[model samples]
Target chain A: MKLSIKTIIPIIVILTACTDDIINNDASPSNIFRSFWEIMDERYVFFEEKGVNWDSIYFDYQPVFDTVRSNSAMIKAFDSILSHINDKHLSIVSNDGHYAGMFLNDTLHYSISFGKVYSTYDFSNLQTYSHLHLAQLPEGISYIRILPGLKKINVNDLNIRQYDYSNGLIIDLRDCTGGYMSGYNFCSIFLQDERVVFYKQTKAGKGHNDFSGLIPLKIKGENIIKKETPLIVLINRNTYSMGNGIASILKENTNAFLIGETTGGGGGSVMSVLLPAGWSLTFTQSKHYNLARKLIENGINPDIENIPLIDFWKEEHLDTGKDPQIEIAISILQTTK
Target chain B: MKITLFLILIYLGGSTLLVAQEEETKSRGTLHNFRFGIGPIAYKNYYSIPNGLAGGSMSFTYQMEKEHKTKKRDFLLRANFDYSYLENSKVLTTSEPLFRRFKIRLGPGLLWPLNLKNNQLHLQAGGNISFYGEYIYPTESGGKHIYHPIPYGNWSINCNALIVARYQAGRITIEESLKVAIFTAGFFPEFQYTPTSIDNSYYWDFLKINTISTIPNYRMIENKIAIYFPLANNQTAISWRISYNHYNFENSQKYIEHNLGVGIRF
Candidate 1:
C-alpha cells in the first residue's frame, strides 16, 4: 500500500524523539504513594531549610504506605510525615470531607472582644461597616477595629482620609484570623517616603538553600495615611498569615506601636496537590521573611508587650479595669493626643 | 564520528529510495478523506469545580484530509474541529445543571506515513487554536455569577500529534489511535486571573473571595482503539471506538474516563 506524505513526516518526527513519562491516572495505593512522594520531591521548596531528609522520609514511609489501604489512613500517614516540617501553610483535606487545616496552626491561642474594648475606650461616636468598626473617640483620636477573615473592605470607603486631621489612629487586629494580603494599606500611608518593610527570598534553583538574591519589599504603595499619625496597631496571638504580613509591614515602616501578644506567623502561601486516591493535600512551597530577613514563620512581636493576664483579671473579678494591655494603649493615645 | 557516519548512511539510503520511487511518486493520485462523528462526554473534577458524575455529555467532530501528490513525497493538508460538553449534576454542583464545559479545537495537520508494507503506519502532528469555556448556569442558592453568559474561558494554542496504524485485510479495518499532547491546558487560564474569595450568595462569581486554588494545570494522555465496519461503498463505514482519557491537573484534578462511541467515517 502506497503511503501518504502526511503520515510519513509526523511518524519520523515522533519516532526520532523519545517521549518521557506517561501520564499516571491509576488510583491504587502504589500510585497514590508515588504521586505524593514525587510531587513533594519535585515541588516542595523548603526541604533544606525544613531540615527533613526527604530521601529517608520516602524510604521509611514508602513501605509503610503500601500496607495502608484507605484514603483516611494515607492522609494521616502523609500528615505524620509533613508534621516533621514546621510550616503553618501546610494542610491536607481528604475527599471524604476530613480537613487537616487545624492540625498545622502552631499551638498558640488568643481571644479578645471588640465589644469589651469598645466599652473600655468609651468612644464619643462609633460606626460599623461590612468588616470594619470605626470610633471617633474623644481627645482627637480615631480608633478602628478590623477583624479577621476580612472580605473586600475598600480603604477608600474606610474614610481614612477623614483621619488626616486626627492626632492618632488605632488599628485593632486583635483576635483576627489571617487572610490574603491584598487590601487596605491604610497603615502604609503613614510612611512618608519609600521604605523597605521586608525582604523576600524565593527558591530559584533546585539545591537546598539555593535562594534568589534578597529582594527588598517596600511598603507597597505611596503614603496612604499622609499624616504621620501616631498609630497604634492592636495584635494578639490569633493575628495570622496576611495579618502577619500587614503587621510586619506596619512594624517596619509606620510609627504604629503593636501592643498585644505576638502574632500567629503564617508567612508563606498555601499550595495544594491531589492524590490518585481522590484526596487533596496542601503544603507551603515558599518561605517568607521579614524586612530584616528573619524567618517570620515565628510570629512578629509587639513593640510593647503589655498583654493583660486573663488569669489575673479573672482572679480580681473585674471586667475592664484590670485589662493592662487596653489601659496601656489608652494611656499612650491619651498622652499623644 | 560513528553517529555522523550512521546519519550519512541514512541520507544516502533515503536518496537511493527516492530515486527508485520516482515512477511510483508520479503515479500516485490526489486522495481525500472526510469524517463526521458525534459521541458523549463525561465530566469530573476535584480541583476548581466540584467533582462527580455529570448529568450528560455530548461530543462532535468533523475532519477533512487532502493528499496532493508531490515530488519529494505526498503533501497533505488536514483540518478538524471537535466540540464537547459535560453537563453538571446537582450532587457536585449544588444547583441542578450547575455548569457545563464546552471545548472547540480547529487545527490543520501534516501527516507522515512511515511504512513500506502497505504503509499502514501513519503519524500526524499539528497545532490547533483551541477555545475552552465552562459556563455556570444559574440555579437557586443566590446571586448570579459575575461571568454571566460568558463561560469562564481560556483561549490558547495546542499541539496535537497522533499515530495511526491502519490495517486493512480484505474487509476488516482496524486502527489504533495513540495521540500525544491532546490539549492538556484546559484548567490553566491563558493569563493570571486575580484570585478571588468564595461566598455563599454568589457562588461562581470569579470577582470575589476564594478559599482554595481551583485553577487546573493539566497533563494528559489519550489512547483510542477503533474498528470500522464496512458498508456497500468502500469509502463510507461505521466505526466502533473505545477510547481512554487520562486527565492529570495539578494535585486536585485526576480522573480516568473510558469512553465508548460509534460514528460513521468517509
Candidate 2:
C-alpha cells in the first residue's frame, strides 16, 4: 500500500513514541536507585568526608537490583545498601517529605526561678541570666536552667575557680530542645578525659554529614579536669538534637548521673539541603553511635529517672526544699572519697 | 421531495432510538464489574540546569458489568500520561542558543479493552495526543533576565497507540499496557522515536559537547512497561501504579511515582 503523508508520519510517530517511552520510564530499579544516589551524592554537603563512592556503589548495586524480580525485593536490597553505611541519618524519604518513625514535638514547659545569678566576677547584682535561670538546692547542688541555646559558664567565673570540685555540679539540660554542638565546649569543663562518646554514620556518597565519632572532653592546657567531681545531668522530654548528644557524651565519659525522662529520639547525622522546592530538607544521612558502638536513635534513658522538681514537690508546696534528684546525686557525691 | 423527507425522518428516528438503546443498556450493568488502570504521570525537564530531571505517574480504573445492550461488550477505557525534560549549563544565560525548551510534555493517551470478563483477558488498543509546553530559563551574570513567550514555537504534538491486557478476581486486578507513539519515532531511530517538532531541529546534541547543548533526549523518551492496580470497596477507590522512567541525557533512571485517587461507587 502506498502510504500517504498523514498515515506515514503518524505510523512513524507511533513507533518513535513507543521507543521514546521505553527510553524515559522511571520505575526501573536501576534508574530509581541511581536517581536516589545521584541526588544525595551531588547535593549532600559532606560527601567526601563521609567516605562515600557514589558511582561505584551505584554500579555494584545495579545488577543486583536488576535481578530483583519484585518491588519488595528491590526495597530490601536498597535497605541493605543503606544499612551498609551504618548511618541512621541516611534514609529514603518518601515523596511527601516525612521520614518514618519521626514525629513533631512541641511539649514540656519549664519555669525559671533562682536564688542568684551573675555573668562576670565584678558582680554588679549579676545581670540576671536571660534565657537561662539558676536554682540552688539547700544541699549545695546548683541548677542552671537553659533552653536550646548554649548556657556557658566560664570555669573562671564559676566563683569556684578559686575553690576546687568539692561540691557536685547539677547541669539542668531539661527543657533544652537542642542547639549547636558548640555548647559542648562550655559544658565539658566538668569532664576528665578526651573520650569517644558517640559515633555518626552516613552513606559514603548520599549527603551523609556525620559528626564521625564521639565528641571527647578535652580542656584547654589542662590534661585532666574535674576528675574527682561527681557530675549530675538533668534531662526531660524537651531535650532533643544536640541536647541528647550532650547527655550521651556525659553518660559515656564521666561519673555524671542522668535524671529525668528519656530524651526525644532525634538521633541522626543531618545533611541540610535547600531544595528547588524552596523549603529545606535536613535529611538524616547517618546513624548515631555511642563510644560502645551502640546506636542511640531513641533518646537516652536517664540513670535516676526523676520528674521535674516542681512536680515532684507539688504536694509539699514548700519553696525551700532540696530537689530530690539532685539531693540523691549529692548524697552519692558526699560519700565519694 | 416527499420521498427525501420520508428517508430523512426514518434515518433520524433510527439514530435516536439507537442512542437511547445504547444508554439504557449501559445502565443495566453493575458499575464495579472489573477494575482497570494505567501507568502514572511522568515529567522530565532541563532548560535551566546541568543534568535535567525526570519522573512518572500511574493510575487504576474499574468498569461496570453488562447490564443492558450498551454494556454487552464489556468495553472499557484506560489512560496514561508521560513526559521528560532536559537542560544544559554550557549555554550562556542570555544569548538565545540554537534552541531551548524550558519544559516539554509528551503524553496523555487512552486505551480500550475488547473483553474484560472471560478469564479477564482482552485485546486492546487506544491512542493519545502528546504536546509540549514552555518553561522559563534561569538568569545569569551579564546576561539579560527576561521572560519571552514562544507561543508554541517549541511546542509540538505526537500521537500514540497501545496494546493492553488485564486480569481481575474479586477486589484484586493486575494489568499491563504497552504503547507506541509517532513522537517516539523521530527520536533516536535505533532506541527511540522522534516527534515532528524535534525533527532536524535537535538531534545528537548530547553526543557533542558545545558552548550550549540541547536538553537530553532521554527525558523525552519512555523506557519501560508499567503495572497498575485499582483498589475499590464501598466508599473509596484508589489506583496505584509503578513504572521505570529514564533519561539517557542524565544517565539516570527512576522508579518515581504511580498513584491515583478515585471516589467511592454505590
Candidate 3:
C-alpha cells in the first residue's frame, strides 16, 4: 500500500520500455531506401504509363542503397535510379538543394525570350498585371502573355474591354513552366461555349494501376473575346504543364491556331512526401489526358509548327521581322481579314 | 533601513495571519481549483510530421473535489483544454511548414485511499471514464501551391486508471500521478488514397474512411509530477508540473509530448 520513490522510478522505467515497441525509428540507408521505394510503388501514378518496371528498379537500387554510408552517396544513388523515369515533376529536395529528374537543356532552342519580345515590339499600352502581361501590337492585335502560375486574378480589373482585338489576339505562353490548373480560368476567357478540355484521374489505392474514374476538366464559356476573332497561341518546348495544357485546350476547343514547336509535356499533377532522411520527394500522383482519351504526358503538337530562326537569347536578335512565328500569325490574321 | 525593517515586520505579521486562517479552514466540505499553465512542449505526430516539433503549450484546467468523512470516498471531476503550436525542428525557410495541435479532455472519477500513514503521506488509486479528442494540422500553406495540406486527428473514449501519491514536507507538497488507458475506443482515419482538396467531397470522404480502433491498435499513457508551494494568502498555491504523454494508434501513427509548466491553483 505504501509507495516509495524507488518503486515509482522503476515502474516508470518499465512502462516507458513497454511503449517503445510502438514506433520504428530505423534511419539506416537500407530502411530509408525501402521506405522511399514503397512510397513510390504505392503512390506514383505514372509507373505503367512510363513503362517503369518498379520491381526491377528496386532490385537494381536496393543493393546500392544498402552499401551507401553517407547521405550524399545515398542521394547520388537515388538520382541515378530516378533518372530512368524522365518526369520533370519528380524531384528530390534535401538540405543540399533540389535534384530534379530531368532538366530542359534545350529550352533556348525552342523558345523565344520574353524580355526580347517585350523590348522589340512597339507594344502600346503595355501593362504587366498579376499573372498576365497585356500590350497592344500593330493592326489592333491584342498581345496577352501569361506568366508562370495561375493565381486568382480579378478579371474585371484587367481592363480587357479596353483592348480592340478585331484583327486578332495572341496568347503567348512560351516558357510558362507550370502552375495550378486554375489556368483554366484564363482559357475560359476566350471560350464561346462550355467545353471539356481534358480528363484527369488520380490515384485511388496503393496499387500502381489503381486510379479513380476519369473526371472531365471543363471550362465555362465567358466569351470575353468574340468567337469570330482570330486567336493565335504561341508556344514552344519551354511551355510545360498547365501552360501546355491550356494550349492544347484552346487549340482543340476554340478556332485558335497554335504556332510553335511541340510543347514540353508535363501532364501529371504532383504531390510531395517527406522521407525519413529529412529529404522530400515529389512525384506525379495524377494523370491527364486529352478529350480523345489520349495521354498528354508526351507533349502536344502545334497545328502549325513554326520554329523561329532568330537567336532569342541575344538582345540584338530581338526583331519582330526575325520572329517567324509571330510574323506568320500576323500574316494569317491579315489574310483572314 | 527603517523602511526595510517596517516591511519585514509587516511580512511576518501577514504570514502568521495566513497560517491562523489556514488552521481555521482545515476541514472544508467542497473544494474547487482553477489552474492555468504555459510551458515548453516537445511533440511529434508521426502521421503528419516525421521529425520532432518544438513548441509552447498553454493549458487551462478546472477541478472540483467533494470531500467525505472517509478518505477513500472522495469524488473528483476534471476538464482540461490545451493548445500547442509546434514547428518543424529544421531551420524554417519559406518552403517549410508549421503545424499546430489542439486537445480537450474531460473525466470524472472517485479516489480510494491505499495508505493514510501519518496523514503526511497519501497514496490513492483512481479510476475515471475519460473522453479525449486531438487534432493536428499545418498552420501555414504547404510546400508548393499545388498540393493540399492533409490534417491528422483522432478521438477516443477511454477507461483511465491512475496511481496518485502525495507527500507533505513542511510548506511544500510533492505529488506524482501515473495514468494509463486500460480500455479505449478510438476513431482514426484509414490510409488516404489522395490528398484532400476543395474540389472533392473531402469531408464526406473522411467520414467514409474512418475506422474504429481498440486496445490492440490504440495505446496511451501519461505521467505527471508536480510540486506545490502555498502562498502567503494560504488560499492560493503555485505549482510546477512536468508531464509526459505517449499515444500510438494502428502501429503506424504515434504522438509523443513532454511538457513542463508552472501554474497557480486556487
How many steric overlaps are in each model, in order? 23, 81, 0
lDDT values for all models: 0.51, 0.42, 0.66
Alpha-carbon deviation at A199 in model 2, angstroms: 1.6
Using lDDT as the measure, which candidate wins?
A: 3
Per-residue alpha-carbon lDDT of candidate 1 for residues B1-266, written as tens digits (9 for 90 to 100) = 24323433443343233323321111225445445545443444432332322333444545554554453233444443444443322122124343455545555555555655434333333333333333322233111211111123333344556566555433444455554554433343211121221212223433332222211333334444455555665345333222223333222333233333454555
Name the candidate that leads on TM-score: 3
Full candidate order by DockQ, most accurate first: 3, 1, 2
| CA lDDT, candidate 3, residue B3 | 28
Between prediction 1 and prediction 3, the one with superior TM-score is 3
lDDT of candidate 3 over B68-118, digit per residue (tens)? 766536687989888988643332233444567888889898777785544
TM-score of chain A of each: 0.79, 0.53, 0.87
What 10-residue stretch in candidate 3 chain A is worst by lDDT? A15-24
Name the 10 consecutive residues with the lowest summed lDDT in model 2 chain A.
A116-125
lDDT of each residue in A141-236, candidate 2, tens digit only: 445555565534444444434323456666667657655444555445655454444555444322234233442223332223356666778777
Cα lDDT of candidate 2 equals 0.42
Q: Give one digit per residue, the lDDT tens place, for model 1 in A1-337.
A: 2343345445433322211122234556666667667656655656766688988987888888889887678777866876787665666555454545443345343355456557766764677876667787666777777665465454556665554336677787776566544433444446666566665555444455555666454543456665467878877767776677778777876677999889877775444444543455565545667766787776889988865665654454145534566667777988877
Q: How many backbone clashes does candidate 3 have?
A: 0
For model 1 chain A, the run of ten residues with the poorest summed lDDT: A15-24
